[model samples]
Target chain A: MAATDKIFQHGTLGLLVPGLFDGTITAGELLTHGDTGIGTLDGLNGEVIIINGHAYQAREDGQVREIAADETLPFASVHFEKPDISAPIEATNQADFETQVVRDYRLRNVFAAIRIDGTFKTIKTRVAPRQQPPYKTLVQATATQPEFSGEHVQGTIVGYYAPQLFQGATVGGFHLHFLSQDHQLGGHLLGFEIEQAELKIQHFADFQVHLPIDNEAYLQEEFDNETIDHAINKAER
Target chain B: MAATDKIFQHGTLGLLVPGLFDGTITAGELLTHGDTGIGTLDGLNGEVIIINGHAYQAREDGQVREIAADETLPFASVHFEKPDISAPIEATNQADFETQVVRDYRLRNVFAAIRIDGTFKTIKTRVAPRQQPPYKTLVQATATQPEFSGEHVQGTIVGYYAPQLFQGATVGGFHLHFLSQDHQLGGHLLGFEIEQAELKIQHFADFQVHLPIDNEAYLQEEFDNETIDHAINKAER
Candidate 1:
């Protein structure tokens, strides 16, 4: 129950890259760690965007809905922290925005949580299709996934920025998901151009990973280094 | 303030490998996260072993002493939990012990804290040379480190078992430090053979890493993947 500015994450990209998508912890359980963050739901069902203590799931059909408390999650990152720095940003494109933000704000090596509220000039994203048993690897799932894009959309972008050292366990760069104000569209952010936005970032030095140790697959499976690195780069980047 | 059975660590082997040895968090503050763990003091002075809520430092000259409240840490891993399982062990060599324990106890892939108290048939260890400014990388520092070894030693071994996924973030395998019962000897464990020992382990699904974000060295340094991986494998193994 410590309201400290640290991230609480469930599972890892390493686990998900290999297609172990069964939900281990529930949405209700995840909320205890943080009030704002992002992740995906059970079986990689779309993308998870947590805002203001509420959990929402965005599906591949450009649909958004509040998740049930009991719904489980295979991978997610949550945090409870007020913004340490908030300001208006001018960078538009994804690459430019990331480069400028990390460089200008001195967020190069440490971890941080970012939230940007604005109208995007052009936004493009995709959602993971919900999977059943015999789940496919993330690369395979995203290979034929549906994508959504628009000219002008007002929404919030939320995610965590991990250092380069956490390459496979988490995203080495920003891993963000978007959710529209109207709750009509959004998913994992693939590309974006912000027209005007207020960026709020909470830089923290700590990250807590909650592994699914109880999952039989997690305890028994061997995680090869090259396979994880290659799969994450191919699927997430 | 939550007494959850998770490995709470400060800094990372990635940071240490590059010689960012300045302590960011004090020993007093680290104890709030876990009581039993292992770490190194500020300036990479020596190896740390926490047992029964007390912190002890073992130096290269075969000396052990209680750490002060104000002592700082460059890296550490700690947890507060009663062992889930405790029993006598028969494996002796480092390789055999790690393989058997992980295989027999189903500890593969998950994170776990291991504690072994035993009579050693033979033990070998080394302590970091107390360092100052213009610190050398771990590989360079450990190159000429003073080592200690003996036969028929009674002591305890404490450390964490990180899955291969951790890699340079922590020791991908077992990273242990040893301390003798009489507080007369021990350091970073290089090798050992147990005559008889009792093993205690707590399998956990969570690991919390506390980065030294405020350290100017940590924030500004560009951690190269090839450098970190190579340095860790060369020095730690």
Candidate 2:
């Protein structure tokens, strides 16, 4: 198949043209006047066109079209592939339920607030959308804390999204914040893994949601409250 | 005021608290509970709490107050100042319009398109934003083309936006694309430049709006028929 057809069939195209910054002609191409009739004559597989009454090379299957000599064409469109977002969740406080519970919740909440806030700020300010899909998302969390607090607590967590998360942004990289309330306690207590659960919408569709395998819903329902309550109730019976 | 308060009031909160990568607090302090905060206490003044659940320190009229463990103090709030946004607008592309009217317009449009497209793509794929502007808005419209296709155009243009115009986004760098068509010569050309721009947004509301000095709208207006017609007429006359 012709380059144009290949691009069309795959919904993508690229060319590593020399002397063009390793230029890759993806699905998009800029076409001008010469591209129209020249293809048939030269056995050129692309389109033809005329600019300022002069012929020029043009891509038959590209999204951009020919412009008059007097008119101008902007870069048309630009985009980059989204990054991956997946990790294991660590349940640090699972070992010491009593003390870890209150401290872990506080740390989790604080870390969540920071991560969400930072990611949102980054996306909104840094990223600019070009077309859709692979919506960019940022996830920041921590499982460790410093020992200066005199309590054996997890560390402080902080994360920031590069481009703030938009309505349909894709997800990217992980920033883990670790903290410990007590100075002496050692080892990774937060031992939970994260699985890619599902992609959904949240905040009234204002944000694209990524539910981590160790999401809050599962923790509260299956692990934390439910498990604890069941154990207590069974013991009473 | 105490050093900590000074830092907070000066709006250098990020600095006062050590960053995740390069922090002031020691690893042992991070792992143990203590009275001293892990990060820098620089510029702090007024009532503050050090160490986890430790006594409070108050700085009033340059005097320091140390609260006892048994003391119960009234509630208080601390506020930090906001950073300045409006700085001098750096002008670029400050060159004499020596080129023919048509080429000038095409060059300007190409420059605008490339800058915007490059920025959008970079932000989308890479999490970092550019630190400087992408294109010099005040391009010197010289009639001469570079000996090399991708080289920067020589000759000085006064009143141009300097350092290229990627003034938005919080991280990464900027990229520029330049397309030039010489109606008098009957051909087209393309080129590019890369740079950086950065912005920090502390709140969600700050991310909702576009950067203040983006020249996109102005560039678009220049591409209108009226502007092109006027330039062409002047050239012919």
Clashing pairs in 1: none
lDDT of 2 by residue, B31-130 (tens): 2222222111212222233322232332322222344443321111121212122122122211121132113222211111111111111110001111
Task: Give RMSD (Å) of candidate 2 vs. truth.
Answer: 28.8
Score residue A27 of candidate 2 by CA lDDT.
20
lDDT for each residue of candidate 1 in A68-170, tens digit (9 for 90 to 100): 8999998889999688999998898989989998998888787899899999999888888988879887788777778898878999999988998898788
**lDDT: worst 10-residue window of model 1 chain B:** B1-10
True contacts kept of 1: 0.91
Candidate 1 residue B8 C-alpha distance from true site, Å: 1.2
TM-score of chain A of 1: 0.97
Worst 10 residues of 2 chain A by lDDT: A11-20
lDDT per residue (tens digit) for residues B15-134 in model 1: 988789998888899888888999999998989999877899998777999999899999988999678989999888988999999888887788889999999999999898888879
Candidate with top TM-score is 1
